[model samples]
Target: MSAKDRIAVFPSRMAQTIMKARLKGAQKGHSLLKKKSDALQMRFRMILKKIVDTKSLMGDVMKEASFSLAEAKFTSGDFNAIVLQNVTKAQIKVKCKKDNVAGVTLPVFESYQDGSDVHELAGLARGGQQLAKLKKSYARAIQLLVDLASLQTSFITLDEVIKITNRRVNALEHVVIPKIENTLMYIISELDEMEREEFFRLKKIQEKKKKIKAAEEQLKQTRRAMGIDVDNDGPNLFAEQHDEDLLF
Candidate 1:
């Protein structure tokens, strides 16, 4: 997935509650992955550039060495015998280790200069000055090859790191983040629906209670009116009893 692409999902109650947490986790993971990926890419480019430069230098050194050797052979009148006897290889020390880059460990190479050894081409009794010149040219070529080899090794390391970084970036951006977001949305939606149902149920109960309270008030008013009527009738009955007693 493109790094710029943002995810889209339905909003929900549980989703809302957990979205912040999930998003934060995803964002943190994504940021780290992006940094790693960028680092790998940068390293790869740098190494590739070095390799190109070293290769070019190597080509030049090879040409110069070949020209020098041809000159020596033409002057000596023995190409094969002279090359086989005179050409000497220099010892190289290559130090290698793993380097940490954006949490990914990769190989790195370093070259060290060792002490030089002198070798005579043949028993031709060559002059000291001529031997020194030939040795210098040969040393240049060997040094160039050493540098090129180091660059090549670094390029290989960068390639492997970049591949691993790309895979992790893809997994987080396309798979892990999406799954967490989906789960969050589901939970939030369910919670919101449950809350709405509970609110409706509470409102119904309140309305029922209000109706009962109004009915109880009406009953109390009716009882009070009946009591007033009874009081008035009691006074009238008392007056009638007084008249009857007087007549007796």
Candidate 2:
């Protein structure tokens, strides 16, 4: 195997156990990441759909608001002063909260009117009716704008999170998991080789032992056939057997 494929492990059962544990951990991590990626993808699609719908509504609201402004300008003969007089500290307040989606936190914005109505005396004189219409149109436009902003922010956040999640999933599936499996295979192969080597060494030792035992038994038979007494003690048996064979 190439150096890159080889795992730096001692050829032992302990290393095999460690590698198995690592493989299990890696698989668990891959499963969790895959789930996270799927969730983020689902959220991303929902946010994208919301953005599309909000943009369409925003376009219509903006067009209506623009036409109302034009009508108000024509009827009130340039009511810039009146409009400026009503302008005060912002009454519409936007508050943000965090939403958790698939382990990702996203900011959610909500807008509400915080103070007294500013349009109470907006059309007190001249084109009161037209001024009222303009104010309503602009209010709708502002509401739509806020909605669109929230959707846009969510869309962007989901996009980034989806991208990051996908990268992690791919890395685990392609790189980390494969490397771990390769290392595991390598360890198993080394262990098997070591076992086979040990078995072969044992077989050779057994064969040598059997040959020596057969030779000693044959010598004992020959000593007995030559009318020489044999003993259980190996050294004495060998000496007496040798002396009798030499005399014959």
Which predicted model would earn the best TM-score? 2
The per-prediction CA RMSD against the true structure, in angstroms, equals: 13.2, 7.1
Query: Compared with the true structure, what per-residue lDDT tens digits does model 1 show for residues 61-160?
Result: 7787777666655555454665466546635566777777677566565666566543444425534444455556877777677667766766776687
How many pairs collide in each candidate, listed in order? 6, 0
lDDT of 1 at 61: 76
Q: What's the distance in Å from true for residue 175, model 2?
A: 1.0
- Return the lDDT, model 2, position 165: 77
Tell me which residue pairs clash in candidate 1.
12-188, 13-188, 13-189, 14-187, 14-188, 15-188
Task: Name the weakest run of 10 consecutive residues (lDDT summed) in model 1.
Answer: 231-240
Q: What lDDT score goes with residue 43 in model 2? A: 82
lDDT values for all models: 0.67, 0.82
Model 2 misplaced stretches (Cα beyond 4 Å)? 232-248
Tens-place lDDT per residue, model 2, 1-248, is: 66486467776788878878888998899899888888888888888888888888888888988998898888878878855787878888888888998788888888889988877776667778888888788888888788778878888888887888788889878877787788878878888998999999999999987888898799989999998888754465432243445654
Error of 2 at 233 (Å): 3.7
